[model samples]
Structures are given as C-alpha cells and as structure tokens.
Target: MKETSEKKAIIKKLMKEGKTYKQISEETGIHPGTVGIYGGKLKKAEREKKCFNGDRHLCKTCKYRASGARSGCDYIIHTGNERGCNPEVCNKYERGNRNETKTSSKGK
Candidate 1:
C-alpha cells in the first residue's frame, strides 16, 4: 500500500486545530466516516482498504452510490460530479453505507 502520510498529517493537524470531523471532511472533501475511521474515532467491525475489492462495477449497486441525487455520493463528495470512482486509485471507496440511517450529509 502507498503511504498516506500526507492525509494522516492533515487529519492530525486538523484535530490539533480543534476541527471537528465534519469540518475536516468539508475542507478535504473526504467522507466524514472515513475521517472518523482514520482518526480512530469510529470503530469498524471488518476493516479493510475501502477500495481494495477492485470493482468499480460494485459501486453501481453500492448503497453509498446514490444516483441522480443532488449530493452525497462518495465520488461526487470527493471529486465532484465530473468524475466517477476510479477503483484502481480510490482507497477511500466504500461498497456500503454505515450501519445506520443518516439524517444529513454529515456523518456521525
């Protein structure tokens, strides 16, 4: 795996600056749950590299990949609507939703 020192540094800096995960996520365009996951805030049951499965096709059926929505897709959230997830490079890709209903775009 490639080193994520830069992203880790940013997360640590944001936390040091007293920025909440929501703030960091908005600033970096990373999904908030990912922020929590990497920051050691949210504990996951079966953790793996988000995109290690190597199947962009899976995104079509992913709960996180909502279609025609105004916002909230992982791809749209990070790289805007112009691009779709590149399974080869997207370590942050996820195939499912968090284990709860989200009332807003911001993650818990």
Candidate 2:
C-alpha cells in the first residue's frame, strides 16, 4: 500500500489530469468519498498557491460560490426564515410565493 502522502499526490495528479472522482476511485481502489476529500484538498492547495500574492477574490468569485444565479441562493433563504443557512448569506434572494404548492406531496 502506498503512504498517505503518496496517495495524496497520486490523487492530485489524477484530478489535475481531469479524471473523474469515480475514475480515480477505480484506479486507486480508494472510496469515492475519500477521493473527494483528497481531491478537495489538492484543489484548495493549488488555488491557494495561485492566489498566494494576496487575492482573496480567488474564492469569493469561484464558480462554485453561492452568488451565482443557479447556486444555492436560488432555493435557500438564509436571512428571513430558514435556520441552517450554512453559508451565512444568500446572494440570490427571491421572494417566496406563499400560494405556491410545495413540491413534495405528502398525502395522496
């Protein structure tokens, strides 16, 4: 078995080469969840290295950030009512339609 550091390096290389999480898991025999963690760390390290010269906007403007229209802000209400607003603020704040039916139909 490879050392943890070696495994992490392999995961990073694979990720940089655009390999999917499932592909890395299949090649390294690591669980997909574990590979995801390693991949996240590797990406974070690379991003940090790139932004080392004081660029906080690196993360703030990330495509994965909630500020995008299709991001978490579209569906989640962070300030008004909902509680578990993990990101603290919702960039896409849309008014709720009280008359709209809920998506989930509980009783047939």
Cα lDDT computed for each candidate against the true fold: 0.59, 0.59
Per-residue lDDT over 1-108 for candidate 1, one digit per residue giving the tens place of the 0 to 100 score: 324676777877897788988999999977788788777732221223444544455555555555465433455444445444354344444556633223466765
Over the stretch 1-108, how does candidate 2's per-residue lDDT look in tens digits? Answer: 778888888898898799999999999898899899988877776765664322343334433334435443223232343434333332333344422313455786
Over 4 Å off, model 1:
1-3, 41-108
Best-matching candidate per TM-score: 2
